[model samples]
Target: MLKWQWRQGIVTLFFVAVGLLLAILVGYSQPAFRSADSGSLSARSGVKIEYPVAEIKTGLPLPSDRTEVQMAAACLPPQRTPTALSFQAKLVTPEPSRAVPKYKPQQRQEKVHPTNYGNRMQRDVHHRRVNNELLVVLHETVGDAHGAISTFQTPHYDDDNQVSYHAVISRNGTVIYLVPANKRAYGAGNSEFIGINGVEAVQTNPSLASSVNNFAYHISLETPVDGLLDDHPEHSGYTQKQYQSLAWLIARTGVATSRITTHAAIDREGARQDPRSFSFPKLLSYLNQYPRPTEIPPCPLPPQG
Candidate 1:
């Protein structure tokens, strides 16, 4: 009876030891919990999960493209602040002619068709729903505006060669409308916009990488002739007229100053460095002249199946 009791006790002890070992092994296999402030996290099934960080302010002027990381951080959230309207302010309304700068209405060559662009998307590459928030992506044509126009006018059946912009501003401040604002322009490839809402991008085609083109309004400024060389770092800078025209066009869109970004800010591939030698303060000065619209038209909803 004593031996049997001792044997029972030994068996119980062995089982307890085994259980503890198994528990420790399982704990080791599981991922450790981390704070939300850290980068991204993944679930057991391998799905990536993102945590919201603080909102990043925009429209602050920076000197060089090296600070793109800060610029790409976040877009401005919609503001609810009421505009101060005093009696004098209401009485002195400017005429529409004086507010908006003159622009030329021109169409791309017939060869540049719908194939070169796509419709703005309501969802992202993952088919996940996203806000169709409009963003203004500033670009610079490496060559003359006519040269860029010619390239856009040429047929590009190949996906790699396909490129276009909603509008192009010449050195003389002539605004040439290319693709319609409602359509997606092939501006920045492999690009993404990190805003208060989180990462924003769309992959319209499997062959192409994700980009912000779906919700971006692309506007390219023609490079000065002296700065046409690919190796040149900076040029004489854009004309005052160009700055005024850019600000004028953007103001009419009703997009907030914070949503305005440069190509360098969104490019993920690290190759783009356009709209160089730009003056954000100058643009802001002109933009301040226009009153912010009370409401911007929302994107049309996707068709229900």
Candidate 2:
């Protein structure tokens, strides 16, 4: 019975040692681990160990600190340079203005001035043609001599090489010869003699048609005047010498004093007012003093038309 009691006592001591070890392990799990060399209470208990209870880190090779591992994961890796984006801005622009055309009118050229009236008149033909039925056409040159000559020399006025005005009176009472007494002068364009022949209804008073009728020998008288119808110096009338010369030429032409019509008188515009400052009464009186032997008839008044 004593031997059985000893065995029981030994088994009881083994169970107590196991319980103490389990209690020490529970205490270690509760407190933070201290160094083995620190002489901790756990180390003195003979149940504590220096080795780690569990592994501190897993995956990613992170440290025991969670804060450090999170900072490392947040850090980004280096990247390639970014491509440049297109920055074009669309803008509405106005179209260019169209060119405008300029309108211009065409120009007309001026006509040429006539040169010679009768440059081709032969001497025989000019002298042989004597116009007995005299129809004198008197002309008074108002402008300069150059203009007068130019007018008389124009071909339009003297076509057929037979332009003949018996005489031309200059401003200074100078008489110019265009043709001799024997040729038909183209002095009158659309005209007729009133005294001797042609229509009597067209007949004007002898004194009125005297200037034109005096061309019996186919001659013309050129008279000069200081003024025309207006009778102003600006109108350019005849000088006293020119009037006297005209009278002399009339007397020489043997024109009856009764038949001197101005261009206006025969043309019948009622606008025919010439010898504006001249006295017809005085001229008649002078003519009365120098009478022609032929019996003078009453002058028929010019037709109004």
Clashing residue pairs, backbone N/CA/C < 3 A, model 1: none
User: 185-295 in candidate 2: lDDT tens per residue?
Assistant: 444433443432223111122222322322322222233443422334244345544554555444444444434555444543344343344545544444343423133
Local accuracy by lDDT, each model: 0.68, 0.37
TM-scores of the models, in the given order? 0.63, 0.39
* Candidate 1 lDDT over residue span 196-226, tens digit each: 4468677877888988887788999988877
TM-score of 2: 0.39
Best by lDDT: 1
Candidate 1 versus truth, CA RMSD in Å, comes to 14.8
